[model samples]
Target: MGDLAAVVAARGVPAQEVMDEYARTLDRLVDPVRHPSLCWLRESGRLGTPDEPDHDFRFGLERVLDGVEALARGASA
Candidate 1:
């Protein structure tokens, strides 16, 4: 993910745009058919259970992107 961020940054993409794409990619990865073991791990709590049921991907990705956005804001400030 870091490598992806670096590449996107090099291309002059806005931070929020990069984060949005990252979030979408993460969402895609959470598909059970595409990543059964990852889905299993999330469901089994190996990836840490989220407060909202069946929202592990959306919740986690939002939290991560939020943090990244905050950091970008702070840096710009």
Candidate 2:
């Protein structure tokens, strides 16, 4: 995976631009295979709305912490 800003290893490319590039790459990778079914909730971006109470929170925090722990343990070994 490529990190934002300063390149993976140069020139003066901004971090946000690199991130946007990555997001577009991810979007291309997961292109929709078929159109929405007859019974589907139609919306933009994602299923949950950002304005909703539960929409924004620590959903990915635990997963990220676990990944860091795994990397730490691997380094120790």
The candidate scoring highest on lDDT is 1
Q: Can you list the residue pairs that collide in candidate 2? A: none
TM-score computed on alpha carbons, candidate 1 = 0.32
lDDT of 2 at 32: 55
- The list of candidate 2 runs beyond 4 A from truth reads 5-9, 31-77
Error of 2 at 76 (Å): 22
lDDT of 2 by residue, 2-77 (tens): 2332362265665555545655665555535553531133224333222223323345677788899999999999
Model 1: CA > 4 A from native: 1-5, 31-77
Model 1, residue 55: C-alpha shift (Å): 25
Q: Give the TM-score of candidate 2.
A: 0.33
Residue-pair clash count for candidate 1: 0
